[model samples]
Target: MENKKALVFGSVLLSGILTFSLYGIGSSIASDDSKHEHDREYEYRDKGTNYSTKSVGTNKLYMEECGSCHMAYPAQLLPTQSWQKVMLGLEDHFGENAELDAESHNSIESYLVQSAARRKGESRKLLRNLGNKTPLRITELPYFIYEHDEIPCRFITGNDKVSSLSQCSACHQNAEKGRFDEDDVVIPGIGRWDD
Candidate 1:
């Protein structure tokens, strides 16, 4: 009977030690993750803005269809009129047949229209320098051009990893989240963008 009691006590003690060890490891891992997130936020804050937390929401159908070919840019990047034009010309979308079924097209159109950049809001900066022109391409927007004008062509077209400025994800790590802060840019072969 004494041996049985000793065995039981040993088992419980071993279990407690194992549980404590696992808990410590888990806590350490969680702390590391928190540190990483803090560092990322600090980097964005240091850049004079905090676009790192932006989230434009998401659409399943839109991501499945449009995102399959290219980055499904945040709808706020364009205006309602521009999205309408793009949807109307899906048969020749940027030199490709991107037409969708009526059901899919209508749904996607509604989503884009609802989230398009408004004349007054977070997207107003994207609409600047426009004098009643409907641009079908985000890259053609005056604000976009102005933001990228300083980047040399060689760093883009010449760099195999980044064929064009249209591929926002190629440089902007958080492009999918609607975060285009300058500090988030890291050109493929070159490095972090200083200019």
Candidate 2:
């Protein structure tokens, strides 16, 4: 009777351990699924609209001057100081004709400064990808460089729409709206990243 009782007790303990392990595994999987769902919802929210409520000055300058040959560089790509430097050097802007009237230039500068990259918190994907150094040029972004690194350098020069690497909006669909996530990246000729 003692042996039988011991056997029964052992079996009960084993069953309890098995049940607890299964429950733990199941709960972990459920937690992962919930996290994935949350990520999906965040991506959905980012895809809502491309309209910006910020100052129209930058957009105006971009459309009028920069948009003719290539897509406008997103304001968030550079820190305010860099934008200030770029604005100050409009006459010799990256080997192109970026000269503008005094009023228009001031407006553009103001807009760029207001939406500077330095203002981004650590939580922002751009800041995370950028790491330590503040990127002055729009093309200097780690993600942007990584995404375009595979493309032949000649392609940028040959393509009128993407003359320079700075023209992110030329390829990325939601660039103007300040959304640079992996999901939003859609190259003009190239479809999408396999990953």
Candidate 3:
């Protein structure tokens, strides 16, 4: 009877471990699914067009430093190398003295690299048309040009509300939240962006 009881206890413990392991695995998968739900929904609804999947999340240091000057543009918008170039040239950041302390610079660089577009799935297309060129500006990306090709200059550079295409949040209402669904765009002065 003693031996039987011990076996039963061991079996129960093993079962519990298996159950917990499965639960953890399932939770990880579910988390990933929820994270990319926006991407999946957009693809389903749009049929062919695509947008960069937002980063896993944002970094506070990056937001505080870069965002204080310009909208903390989503890091996923650029490739790893591009982000490296941008961070490396902070002293001459678009003709401004945007250099940061070593600690802050390192932190921001890591965040950007981790969040940058890897050459996978739709991200591969993001690097398309660029033959080994590491573009420092998001506006210089080929994909960016292709997407905004339709918008007239008058609506961007000419419009006071939107000084340039760099002001993503100007038209993309949810840009700061890493959501750039074309449907949500509301170009200021102009109503909704049909294109």
Candidate 4:
């Protein structure tokens, strides 16, 4: 009788464990389905494209030093080598005195190079295409120009608020967050860009 009781108890415990495991598997599948559905619904509602995915820099020194003058563009916009060159040429940063002290300079330099663009995925595939080049200006990069090919100079260089094409946030509402989706674009004088 004692052995029979032990067997019954073991069976009940195993049954419970199996049930919980199955439930967890089912829940994960349901969650993935929900995300797909949400994406489909968003595309149907939104008139523009998505940012897909982009990594934003989180270094405090990089923000304070680089951003103090111009918009602290995302470090991933450039490759590791490009960042190295930029940090090496601060005194003449695009024809400006962006020189920083050793400590601050080293910190910002490390951050930019470490957080530079990767070489894969939709967000970073462009980095791989930039073979044989280490462009200092993000605007001059072939991939960046291709991405902004639809927009004319009038909407960018011609606009007072956006003095040049380098001014990303001038139109990208979530540029700081690394999102440059087509739907989020809204030029100051003009409206949504669809091309």
Candidate 5:
């Protein structure tokens, strides 16, 4: 009977030690995850201007419906106000009937606003020349114009494959992935464009 009591006590003590050890390890892992999330560029901001490195389309419906027409364009390409305006005027979206039900519209608008570009880095350059202007077209951005300035009108407007600069995927291989590195650009009919 004494031996049995001793064995039971020993087992309880071992169990307690194992539980504490596992708890410590879990806490350490949790701390590391918190640090990683903080360092991530796409951390959600409740109310502030900040750029996000994360790819767009956190909402499936937004990507499927909006992308059905165009590249769906990265939400990071515009500011929160610009996204709001676009959502408000979806019925007349660039002469296209992009009408959406109120629920879907609100959901898409929320996603766009949340994913909108920060007023920093390249995003700042995009809005540089414009003051208090919310351009409906992403191509209207000064940075976009500057980037495409070297390419003659013949290549863009003339090329049947690329009707407009807005057709980002025409030249950018990874436009859908939001990677617009100039090195990857290859005009459809014109072929590779190192410039």
Candidate 6:
């Protein structure tokens, strides 16, 4: 009778473990699906063909010039006034040494100013951090700093693909296409458990 009771107890314990493991797996899958749906909805609702390849003038300059090195700084990352400051300081761009032609410079400046961070709605974390203040340096961006806090300084400078800490998408999985959620982050050379 004792042996039979032990057998039943073991079976129940095993069943509980299996149930918990399956629940965890199911929850992870459901979370992934929700995130995917959110991204899809954001893309569909925020459509305006202009930010894409069809962008002209300064927008083109951003893609052709800036994008060559890193993801184009999202227009919503800075207030409109801040974008103006950055555009005006293009001659002294942080490190790339950008020197734009007058027409291209004006075009890019206009596009950036028009789509400045101020114009963005409250949905963006970057904009939220700005808090009505116009920031001059992209590095000053709160969201940028928060996202990069985990990255080691050596990796950022050592990696060829990543020149500055501002390049979030370089290591982050969904960064190339403009998704920076925590779930989307997959640090290279690190295991999921580490994350």
What's each prediction's TM-score?
Answer: 0.71, 0.54, 0.71, 0.70, 0.68, 0.61
The full ranking of all candidates by TM-score, starting with the best, is 1, 3, 4, 5, 6, 2
Clashes of each: 0, 0, 0, 0, 0, 2
Better of 2 and 3 by lDDT: 3
Error of 6 at 153 (Å): 5.0
lDDT for model 1: 0.82
The numbered model that scores best in lDDT is: 1
Please, what are the lDDT tens digits per residue for candidate 4 over residues 69-173? 888887767888998999899899889999999988877777677666767433374564688798999887887888888888899989998878888999988
4 or 6, greater by lDDT: 4
Residue-wise C-alpha lDDT for candidate 6, range 31-121, written one tens digit per residue: 9988887664232122345465435445657778667765786665567788777777776777556777887777777777666654344
Off by over 4 Å in 5: 1-58
| Per-candidate RMSD, Å | 7.4, 11.2, 10.4, 9.7, 9.1, 10.1
Q: Give a tens-digit lDDT track for model 2, residues 1-195.
A: 999999999999999999999999999999998886556412212211443644654566666666666555566666676688888777777787778888777777777676656433522444546656655576676755775687766557667766776666666566665555566665555566445
Candidate 1 weakest lDDT stretch, 10 residues: 42-51
lDDT of each: 0.82, 0.64, 0.79, 0.75, 0.76, 0.65
TM-score of 4: 0.70
Model 5 TM-score (2 dp)? 0.68
TM-score (C-alpha) between model 2 and the true structure: 0.54
Cα miss at 123, model 6 (Å)? 4.8
Q: Model 2 segments beyond 4 Å from truth? A: 1-54, 57-62, 119-123, 128-135, 146-164, 167-170, 186-190
Rank the candidate models, highest lDDT first: 1, 3, 5, 4, 6, 2
Residue 97 accuracy (lDDT) in model 4: 92
lDDT of 4 at 103: 81
